[model samples]
Target: MSKVEDAVAADAATLGAMQINAFDANQPEPLFVEPYAVTGWATFIQRAASSRSGPQARVGVIRDDSGNVIVQGSRHSLTCLLHIARDNDAAADLYGPWQESWGAPPPDMSKDRLDAFFGEMKAQHKAVMGNVPHICTFIFPKSRGGGGWLTAPMTDLEIIMTHSTARGRGYGMALLQWSNEMADGFGLPLYLDAGEDVVGLYTRVGYVRQPDELRTSKSLVPMVRAAVKV
Candidate 1:
């Protein structure tokens, strides 16, 4: 039997390796930097697991009968910033002292490219959602300390991936259903930006894709699942 359990900081390295193995092929863009991929993932997982004051961030891993993690997923509420903003010059140089502070690897893309990418993403998010309760897939911390997007309260299924060797099973859907339960409890709509290949899966769980005109890129489609009380 398989069971879903909360992922702790010690699971970071394992989850990082799993992440690299799972998303390495056919990713729209490089999801993690080369040498720093594991480090970056470890940092993110550690922060999410340890930080108590920020939006509620939870990670769940599905373990096989032998206790091997076959799937990992995360959910976070977008109620407020994880940490307060501080002075920063990192925006000008993304991979400098600020990078150390963030303790995570920056995206594989260049600073200019990342800026343009995030800029368009933010624009689309603002235009489509417009101050409504929503969740986001990505957030960057400020240079001086911890920080995150301050948004209207909503639940987000941030990352959900099954191990490459375990893909044919229903682990992914199980994780999605787990997140749906939490979103239902919050009584706010759940939102995410889905990759083209997986949009159908999300749709099956009540995620309605946004208009094509709202897309910032051809590969990503934003979707929302309305809150439903159980």
Candidate 2:
């Protein structure tokens, strides 16, 4: 395998492990079926790597010299990100006080949702950075459809903290800084979605609330199921 291919595989493995670990650590009831998490991430990694637009999407991980994977983060395709945000607990936490939110947790291996999300993402792949692991968990950039604004564009950062132990370690800041530099390099306005608890953190980094655009939802079914599974 080429070096990049090897890297992608390693990253996929790391991310899969981290996702499972994070879920186990934080959820009162963990829902990952052992093989599913690993296999699922592997599938994502392979597909992304094989795609023509794959290289532009970055995947990163923190590892020891022994090459053991530690932390992993990803920037889902815009559509994937949208779906993720729709069902994301972390996003809900960030937006809870602002407005009521609702959605079901993503069903496992929902072929239709996955296919549609991925297909749309691939069609707009030029604007996407595939599941970036660590040091910019989830950042996305977009251009206005009609205006064709050239000099400046808009970008969004969506960071997810799956492990409590990973908090306060500066990893989050590192990721934010990396993302900001990337956006600044492209001369795009940086945007983000953060929970109320971490508002101060983002504020310190120069992010402001888009209060008018804020909306929230709660999924009692998913939440309860997650609790029971844990």
TM-score of each: 0.66, 0.48
Question: Judged by lDDT against the true structure, how good is candidate 2?
Answer: 0.33
lDDT of each: 0.49, 0.33
Error of 1 at 8 (Å): 1.2
Query: What C-alpha lDDT does candidate 1 achieve relative to the native structure?
Result: 0.49
Mind giving the per-residue lDDT tens digits that candidate 2 earns over 174-214?
Answer: 44545445545544344333333454555565554443323
Candidate 1, residue 101: CA error in Å?
Answer: 11
Candidate 1: give the clashing pairs.
none
Which one wins on TM-score? Answer: 1
The backbone clash count of each candidate, in order, is: 0, 17
Q: Write the per-residue lDDT of candidate 1 for residues 1-230, one digit (tens) a residue.
A: 23457665565666656555555444556545545645655565565567443334456677655555434443211111111111122112212232442353454546665455455544555555554543433212111121211111126444565444555456656666666666676565666656655667778878888888877655456777777766
